[model samples]
Target: MGDFVKEILVKPIQYADEVVKLADGAISFRQDCLEVKTKSEKLVSLLRQAARASGDLYERPTRRIIDDTEQVLDKALTLVLKCRANGIARIFTIIPAGAFRKITQQLENSIGDVSWLLRVSTPADDRDDEYLGLPPIAANEPILCLIWEQIAILCSGTIEDRTDAAASLVSLARDNDRYGKLIIEEGGVGPLLRLAKEGRMEGQESAARAIGLLGRDPDSVEQIVNAGVCQVFAKILKEGHMKVQVVVAWAVSELAAHHRKCQDHFAQSNVIQLLVSHLAFETIQEHSKYAIPTKHAMSIHSVVMANNQKNDMDVTDANYRNNEQDDECKSKIQRPRGCQRIVKCTIW
Candidate 1:
């Protein structure tokens, strides 16, 4: 193929990357932008795989697929621009919410076309899969193929792709302990840890949920913890939105359940303080005439472990019983065995 043709074929993939970047920057319809970003990423992956194989990318079938992909990406780019604009002043010119639905379906169709092209296009017998950056597995099990695909997407540069991959991993991990172990074995934790820090709030929440489910195997949960999941979770718990905070709390609880080693690791990360702030009592300034509530700060582990045991749990204290005490209140947190702390709580 001529240089011009190769450049023509490469433009769509480049455009897809651009779409992924701008989609993440969208200030409105962010979730829909994520959908656009994920689908565009799939197209990029599929198109690159097709190019890497020995198949003639400039041939009619591959050329047609690239052309269609570019058209879809053109629409996606337009949509992303509108989303970023927020359309507040667009009035009659505003893009409809359903526009995202149509664009996503078109992108999905393009992805399917590229996948089909990759499946049917014959490559040189000596082609090395390593050059393609895709698993060359020819397995009968669809689940195995699915797992590898998601793992590859997990390693993608965009948060939307990683978030989508993590959500899928959660589903796959839930199937059995074996798949969960396989995910960890395949080194999915590194990107996930990156996602926890770099992804948007929605993506971070999904990553945390997936990390918790992957902790089903205590053996591999330690791998995640050793990869600094505690530090990441602590950061999220400290700074992330409340929904994400709750998810990370659950993951922290899962990891901490495995060993005292993990708990100590979390303690060093100061996750204990972040977790406490969640269950912290209302401050005296928030409400003056409220009831004398009994609440205590607990580690993420203790908070989770104490949830079901809340009926049997109690706070032992010598602090002021007077609801109107102006002094700081100190209380003894009594929960499960091994989880006892003197935590200070406010009276509401």
Candidate 2:
């Protein structure tokens, strides 16, 4: 019985340690790549914490920690792949074709190795239905029905699953107004708003994109406003990753375009002020893509100012009308003759 328990528990702990070491090796291999290094370091930190926590005799590895570790590793792998692809793209433009091919092959092999390690480290029970809710629909099921299912996953899935589901929903909504509308109608806004506010980096990124895409639909704008999306977007614009900030700004622009209420909310939330501050920094202005969204935000600011001025004028006009009516009423009233006569005598 002791041997069986050791085999069941000790081996898996050893496997997890091996996985952590492999992740550390990958981190060292990509030390020069800051983005890759940052992500890998996070994975290492999470795995180490998990390992330490699991070592306690009275405790078992919690599902949340395991899920979080896997998610971090997944994000690290993605960053590694993206860094390699970017390197390849840059090298291909300057290097000989043979050299390019060799470099590409090396990158592919490296990515494959990391992918294999990730798979080996992942427990066999980590299926889509485990992290996500409910199994996928049968092949015979109608496509239209899948929308609700996807929304359900977005609402209830684990962090990583919710991120993917949000990305999938955005992809479906792109160029499809009907799908965007459906997402709003199906109660997707609340979950997305929460994700944008509290999710991990990837989750926030996907949620921002999804919200931005959905904001393009006129009907969805009010739903987004009621979800307090302006506050989330404002926070993202101020503190999110640069790529995500651009998307959030664009979404703000879209929401400002057709909805007066959204515009007011954004203005009141100080999103316009944040964008204006961004514009003052030379680094932000150097990125041309950033300018596009900043421009849109400034446009919203202009509209807000114009609206305020108009409101002020309207109030002034109303006050003037009231004053004029009061003067007319005073003119119609007869003054006492004795008072007038006393004034004439004093003057004489």
- What lDDT score belongs to each candidate, Candidate 1 first? 0.66, 0.54
Query: What are the per-model C-alpha RMSD values against the true structure?
Result: 21.6, 25.3
Q: Which stretches of candidate 2 lie over 4 Å from their true place?
A: 1-141, 283-348
> Ten-residue segment with the worst summed lDDT in candidate 2?
56-65
TM-score of 2: 0.42
Q: Which regions of candidate 1 fall more than 4 Å away from where they truly are?
A: 1-138, 281-348
Candidate 1, clashing residue pairs? none
Q: All candidates' TM-scores?
A: 0.45, 0.42
- Cα error, candidate 2, residue 276 (Å): 1.2
